[model samples]
Target: MTPNPPAVPRARLPLRAADLRGLSRLGVDAVVGVTDVVEAMHHTIASVPGIVGPAPAGRPSGITGFVYRTVRATTRTVGRGLDALWAAVPFDTTASTPEREAFVAALNGVWGDHLADTGNPLAITVSLRVGGRPYREALATPTGRLLVLVHGLAMNDLQWTRRGHDHGQALARDLGFSPVYLHYNSGRHVSQNGRAFAELLDELVAGWPVPVEELVILGHSLGGLVARSACHLGAARPWMKALSRLVFLGTPHHGAPLERGGRLVDAALGLSPYAAPLARLGKARSAGITDLRFGNLQDADWQHRDRHSQTRDDRAPTPLPAGVATYLVAATKAGRPIGLHGATAGDGLVPLASALGEHRSPALALKVPASHRLVVASANHWDLLDRPEVYRKLRSWLR
Candidate 1:
């Protein structure tokens, strides 16, 4: 009888030793966070009976405090042990799989600020790349025309390739433009990423293999906000001189309602003493996520204020960069216009008016020319990345 064929091993995610260490640390943090919440709840409930004025604030006293403290201490000790064990394991410095890159990007988007603050290995450092590798190695035939593609929140450079179609690659092939991708931690504040990006671009232009004739930026969703921030901060830098065009696809220029809704939920949870402790969970979201509430692109916009507090749109007016051909692309789920509904109809996450840079306050409007705007009907947010019509428009404008 013929021997049975060897079973194929199930494919696993390409997790590294460093990932294990980072995840262990995050696990410890989670446990400590849960203990703090539980202790706060316990203290609040215990002090509720026959109390005057406001509920007692801060951690519980005596035995309760000791128990909570012990839990945290034990968790940290275990985390340190795990870190040492993982660090001892020899890790192969091979290229990361696309799945692993996506996972890291998403993790960075959710808790990137905390990860950076804690020096976690999972936190992605900002870089410019080509074909999942550093840009310098892939630019053997660098061209004068350059296209820089920046991805949206919770995304990495590899994500630009959708359904076998990448806008950057297509532009490179058709327009003789060399495409470079910007990969960054989307969980950090937009202003922070923007400043870093500006510095990177300054270095890139200064050290370009060829004289950069044109520098075009194609930004998607939150990527557009970062690009705008970079443009503003890098106005006096050398890279700005070569920047000729900027295109935004499905960008929330004003603000996204979802983030604002999240803030409202935070406010609602903060109203009751019993539920106040739970507010910490909402507030735990990264600084980058909070910046989306009003599309904050400058440090002054968020420096002193409590990000969780519900406030008016007090963002400083930032007009589009001057002397550059700027294009705005907005998408809507609805196939056609529908009167008053058209004002708010968007690509599920961003409103039409916001994407079009139409704000109630005149000072905040982007002021893009009418010819520079395009609206794609019956398209969702992600469709802006690869729809044939969108590609056609991009080619026509860039050409």
Candidate 2:
């Protein structure tokens, strides 16, 4: 018998030193925040006079100050030592597991922009994935048609394959279209992600190995909002010329009721003097979560205002692109008896009206024709990914 070849080692998730650093920073911020809150509470209890309170007593001059300085120096030294130790460990950068990716995606969805801004190791850079590898490395040949799939909040690109079925792979096999999944930090504002996506798409199109003839986009939830934002921002770019169709899967075009409810809770907490400090806890939600309150798609929607304040829906209406064919898919939990509750409850996350873009204001309405709209009964928001009917509808549209 021939000698057996050596078994290949299974790839392990890389040790990310940045995660430790980011966590350390977050811990520091939390401690500082608590300190500030405690100080404020003490001041409130003391009933200090004037808008600006008097400064506290001066620092200790001798032994106490020396001891304080030594403690501070020791803490700094320990932190630096930990950082150095982590950095020295060799880590395989490319070895990442799906579970880890999902966790990071959720974390990024909550604090992605902040992480990216601070150069945190956990920040996910937006990119296309093909054959379980980065697109640039794996895509040696390209097809004429491209189908780009964008996932919802707190979701990674790997999640597209639900119950062993991925719409992108299905489309690729059935229609001969190339499928590219976007991996991004969902914690950033929709407009910020949109702008980055616009630039990335332009670069991608320019660098494509094959001449791109058509481009189609499928977005789920917040991903749809990001796609819409990209379209608005990329109107003048060359890549816009290749755009042909855009489909939304349970997108909250109008806004999400859950976020609105959260905002109400925050506002209520702030109304009472005793609960005012507790309001800060509510306000700790990421910028991305706040943007969901009004399905904000443009920078102007949030650039000037306080994101946590109970503000009216001031978002400028962004109509669907003139030439592109647009489609909407809404999901309802009820199978039969699709009555008020079924319609209003809306897949438990998004209401049917919002998913269908049925705004009372004509200016804000998406204008997707009735023929282009689909409603999946007995399905929740996430069910849109793997449901057979949803797949059939997608096939019919793209066919």
Q: How accurate locally, in lDDT, is each candidate?
A: 0.89, 0.82
**Model 1 per-residue lDDT tens digits across residues 226-333:** 999999889899999999999999999988999999999987877777887898898889888888888898888888899879488899887788899999999888
TM-score, candidate number 2: 0.87
TM-score of each: 0.95, 0.87
Give the poorly placed runs of model 2, Cα more than 4 Å off.
Answer: 1-15, 48-81
Residue 78 accuracy (lDDT) in model 1 = 88
Task: Write model 2 residue lDDT over 1-399, tens digit each, in one string.
Answer: 999999999755444666666666555455555644554444444444344333233344467556555655665566667667767766646566786677788889877777788677778888878745788887655798888898999898889999999999899888888988888889899998899888888988888889998999999999999999999988999889999999999999998998898889988766654455566777877777888898999999899898988469878999898899999999998874268987897989899989999888898988788999999888999999999988899999998
Model 2 gets an lDDT of: 0.82
Candidate 1 positional error at 144, Å: 0.4
